[model samples]
Target: MADAPQEIEALIDMMARLPGLGPRSARRAVLHLIARRGQLLAPLAQAMQAVAETARECLNCGNIATADICPICASEARANGELCVVEDVADLWAMERAGVFRGRYHVLGGTLSALDSIGPEELRIPRLLDRIEAENITEVILALNATVDGQTTAHYIADALEGRVRVSSLAQGVPVGGELDYLDDGTITAALRARKTL
Candidate 1:
């Protein structure tokens, strides 16, 4: 890397910082991209630029979008009185990919973590509470990860909305400590179908 051109080395360093990519993998990816600049690299660069400029978090659900509200939030058909609460936008996308949920979603941004000083205020808990009555929500499904923090956050939310609405959680299909983004579509569907009251 020290011998490589400064610009190329900088690109490799940035790529290396990406999740699942190390220095070696980034170096290989850079070389591959350079070799196919026209077919892959150029298009990838353009797409990245476009998203960087246009991507915004949906104000209603915290989902990634180009406008104030995401398509799902804007759609009247999605208002089924059920709201699936996920820890992050990735989890919401995973649920959408499964195509088992017909209602709306609420992204909490992250779970509660005492070590990290993350509390209900750090997440979208206040907004979620407001949405329950604003949307006439009947059920709130906790689709958070199976980690300790995730369960803690779920319990906190359940307690907060104890009498306001019904609260439930995904069933046994999810493995302990497993994240929603890594689950298979079938497993996600089964979990949703077998969700239990919190």
Candidate 2:
């Protein structure tokens, strides 16, 4: 790196810090970007700058957006009286990817954790309660992860919304078409506990 151009080396160093990228890959990527500077690198830099300037979290749901409210919240059709609460925006995006859920979403940013000192205030819980009444929500689905923290958060939310709206969770299972033998013990147990009649 000593003999390399300072700007190129700096770029490689920064790229290497990105997830799943290492020094070798970063160096290769830098070289490729430099080779295609006119076609790719310049546009990529401009796009990054634009996003950095405009990207912000949605005021209502905590989802990343260019504006205060995201497109989902602004849409009329999405206000279907069902709100799916998730631990992160990533989970919200995953739900959208599946394309089954037609209702709106609420991103908690993260689950409540005593160790990290994260409480309801830190997680947009109050905003969620406000939305429940303001949006005429009839059901609140807890789509949080299966982790202990996720479950605790779900239970807390259920208690908070008790007598206000119907609360439910994603059914426990081996995933669609997944074999029981491939699942972990806890998953098997949850599936058994949540069994339904055919």
Candidate 3:
């Protein structure tokens, strides 16, 4: 690093600031990119530049998109009256990856956190309520994480839409193919509570 040019060192430092990356990992990544400048570095730089210029949140669902509305919201087939509410775009993407859900999604941006001063207004709770009527939503499936904050947010949403529409939550439990020995007590309890008859 001492012998590296200032520009290279700066790039490494910037990369280090990325989530899950440290100075050592960023340095190694920078070295790898430099070694594959034409094959990877240039293309990656171009892609990042393009996304930086065009990336914008979907006006309706808060999904990342270049246009005003994301493709999911734009698709008529996705307006199935079943809206899946997630905490972030990452969770929305994860649901999409599963390919089981066909309805649209609502990104809350974050959960309700009293300590952090994040409330319904801070998230997209109001927008979600508006979307329910506007999109003719019949059910809202809370797909928030299993964290305490997530459950708090879910309960808040459920209470808010109690009479307006049907509100449900994603079942929490053991993962598929998970061993009982590896599961925690809370997970085991949740799995038992959510058990369905075959």
Deviation in angstroms for 137 in model 2? 0.9
Error of 1 at 84 (Å): 0.3
lDDT of 1 by residue, 1-198 (tens): 489999999999999999999999999999999999999999999999999999999999999999999999999999999999999988988998999999999999999999999999999999999999999999999999977899899999999999989999987577779899999887798789878899
Off by over 4 Å in 1: 173-198
Model 2 lDDT per residue over 1-198, tens place: 697899989999999999999999999998899999999999999999999999999998889999999999999999999999999989999999999999999999999999999999998999999999999999999999989999999999999999999999988877888898789998889888888899
Runs off by more than 4 Å, candidate 2 = none
Instruction: Provide the global lDDT of candidate 3 against the true structure.
Output: 0.95
User: For candidate 2, what is the TM-score?
Assistant: 0.93
**lDDT per model, in order?**
0.95, 0.94, 0.95
What's the distance in Å from true for residue 88, model 1?
0.9
lDDT of 3 by residue, 1-198 (tens): 588999999999999999999999999999999999999999999999999999999999999999999999999999999999999999999999999999999999999999999989999999999999899999999999999999999999999999999988887888989999999999999889889999
Query: What lDDT score is found at residue 167 in candidate 3?
Result: 88
Query: What CA root-mean-square deviation does each model show from the true structure?
Result: 5.9, 1.5, 1.1
Distance from true position, residue 138, model 1, in Å?
0.7
In the predicted model 2, the residue pairs found to clash are none
The residue-level lDDT of candidate 3 at 72 comes to 96
